[model samples]
Target: MRSLKNAFAAALLLCSAMASAHRFHAGITDISFNARTGNTEIVHTYMAHDVEALLANLYGRQFDLTDPDDQDVLRKYVEGRFWIGGQDKARLPLRWVGMTADPEKVTVFQEIEQTPLWKAGAIHDNVLIDFIPDQVNTVNLNEGNAVRTLTFDRNQLEQPTR
Candidate 1:
């Protein structure tokens, strides 16, 4: 009995430590970016599972997760501000940002934190970010100063092809 208790206690401690070390943050999902004529278009999405769990993980409280409300909160924040390249903030800070949602989908487009593809771990969710905002713009961007850590589960990335 004592040996069993000792083994359980050690297992519990190890599990706790690992969980703390890798609490899921937030990051971009199903995202694509394109630029045209000095105007940039950033497209990113959120999964139904992400909004509640990831937000609660980061903020320590469950936000009002209504489809429309969740979409709005996320859209406004990304549109209003983003870190881009060497610039201090949103490269093309929008005058306005918009959100629209159906039962289980949210989409956003606005100025984004843009970066080059060579960056290691340079993308995140909870915000919109564009890659190579200008093919001819000739500016090399870095991802060293991202605002939030985004998490994409291996399970999702490894979904069985249908």
Candidate 2:
């Protein structure tokens, strides 16, 4: 019984430490906005999740974005981790500071921090992305339709379509 308890405690400690140590994918892409900018640059990183549903989530009312609540809804949506920058190349640890958005651009900024996965010094990544927010997102290439998926294109984004 004592050995089992000790083993369990060790496993728990290792797991908790590992959980906090691992890095996660995070960044801002397709950033675009011009409406709200005061204390910080408001940026937007489009997410595949439906925007309409997000509006209803923020202020407890259906939002049309073009309405007055547009900015408020956007602010609420990106409060924690609503923006999707699509920069999944590396496991990035970032704390979103401010945001803004429009149909053409979505940007997010985080203080320079250690990118443990990068092997080098801090990544200092303030990703600014400019791309069409396609609703038809992509899964891994094994699922087929590699041409449609954004991952392949993002890596070699400038390459002409063959």
Candidate 3:
């Protein structure tokens, strides 16, 4: 009975340690054209805890994502890191549609008015990758009944939308 108890305790300890270790850093972004609105919409989702940690490390303070100032800071960081280019290689005018956050995740919304998804020449997404070496961002492009996935990692940051 004592041996079994010890073994159980050891297993619990190992599980706890594994949980404490950072397992993965990842983000998801979805880009789609809204036919009804004639707009190109973009949504990005990231782990809330990871974003909080990143903000704390960068600004040396805890950030309340609910605050406009804090959200703007994150927005600026994101804008600098991620963007979609037009066929002319110029960045599309992406308007920030704001963000929502919960304890588990943060979701950001953006849009390009009157632009079609097919007009997008390239995509650049490196959000959190600069801070987290192991970060990976997956972008899903949704068109009429079709979905294409592009992955951004340390090795690949930009990809053609075509």
Candidate 4:
């Protein structure tokens, strides 16, 4: 009977640890066009722990996000994964501005300097889908007064920002 109680306690501890280590696969991206600046702003937010784990798995080493080298790697990764296409189907250039990391989330700021003079465009956001199969990224495109939202996962890679 004592052995049974000890086994139950061990099982409970194992479950608790697993729960604590589990990562939520989700991110949010807000895209807005500024007529005054003639540029498009992008703010991408993700859970810091999830991003760290994903980068660790990809690079075969743990990344300290606060480190400049680690941040450069992350910035490069994001630049390649996320994109916007203009009316001619040409990819819009995304320039990484900076990033902010809180305890819970990491937010990246980017901008498309040459604004596309189109009513609609295509947005490709594959943030963590390469490392996380169950990853879900929600993108909000704000064009003038209208806001359009699209959710991307493993199945859907890009969506029209119309």
Candidate 5:
């Protein structure tokens, strides 16, 4: 009976430790067409702690996302990892709109002017996947009343926009 109690206590302690150490590594991206602007806008949302950890791992130093230079670094990194291809398989000209960061979350804004959402053929989003193997990204395609979703992970980085 005493041994059973000891084992139960050990299991409880182990479970608590594992729960405290585990953190979710995920991001969400939204691609939507704006009729008023005649553009396709993209927005990415991620955990602020995860972004800071990624920046620190890449540059070996902490980054202030509010600073232009730091934001540019993150922009370049994101651009290289995520993009939309045209029907001809050519990459679209995705302009960086900007980004916002608070204590808990980081939001990035991008847009392609004069392009319809249906014009996108393929999407490649592997943001933070290289740095964190467990990272996963979900892209939501919002077109009119219909909505579609594509998930990206370490194994699947690119997928047809349709």
Candidate 6:
């Protein structure tokens, strides 16, 4: 019984250590064009802790996840890191909407107006890449009825969103 208890305690400690060391470094972005509104909507989702860590490193200050000022800072940071281009390779204008944060995650929303329907475009997403070397950012582009996925990592920074 003593040996079994010791083995269980050791296993629990190992699991806790592994979990702390292997935090996931990733984020997901969803983009869709609204025909009725004539706008392209973009939503980016990230882990709250990861975003807080980023804010601290970038601004040299601690930020409350639910604070409005902190959220604005996050919005500006995300907008600067994310970019989209049309078929002509001209940068599309992005209008920041807002962001919402819960204990688990934070989601930021933005929009680009007057985008043509079903047009091919490209996106450059470098969110969290500067802070985390292994960060993986995945973008999902939704057309009228179809959805396409693009993945960006340390090796590949941008991709076509067709």
The most accurate candidate by lDDT is: 3
TM-score of each: 0.36, 0.27, 0.91, 0.84, 0.88, 0.85
Q: In candidate 1, how many Å is residue 44 off?
A: 5.2
Q: Please give the range of 10 consecutive residues that has the lowest summed lDDT in model 4.
A: 114-123
Per-residue lDDT over 79-158 for candidate 4, one digit per residue giving the tens place of the 0 to 100 score: 88998888667788788889988778999999888674353478888989988899999998776678878999999998
RMSD of 5: 3.8
Winner of 1 and 3 under TM-score: 3
Q: Which regions in candidate 3 have their CA more than 4 angstroms from the true location?
A: 1-18
Clashing pairs in 3: none
Cα miss at 141, model 6 (Å)? 0.7
Model 1 C-alpha lDDT per residue in residues 1-162, reported as the tens digit of each score: 999999999999999997786343333433223333333334444444444454566568766644567656655555443323222322333322455434454555553334322222232221322211111111122223433323334222211101
TM-score-superior candidate, 1 or 5:
5
Model 5 clashing residue pairs (backbone): none
Off by over 4 Å in 1: 23-39, 43-61, 64-66, 83-162
Q: Is candidate 2 or candidate 6 better by TM-score?
A: 6
Candidate 4 ranges beyond 4 A from true positions: 1-23, 114-120
**Over the stretch 15-104, how does candidate 3's per-residue lDDT look in tens digits?**
999888778999999999999999999999999989999999999999999999999999999999999999999999999999999998
C-alpha positional error of residue 95 in candidate 1 after TM-score superposition, expressed in Å? 9.6
lDDT of 5 at 72: 100
Query: Of the pair 4 and 6, which is ahead by TM-score?
Result: 6
Write the candidate numbers in order of decreasing TM-score: 3, 5, 6, 4, 1, 2
Most accurate candidate by TM-score: 3
Q: How does candidate 5 fare on TM-score?
A: 0.88
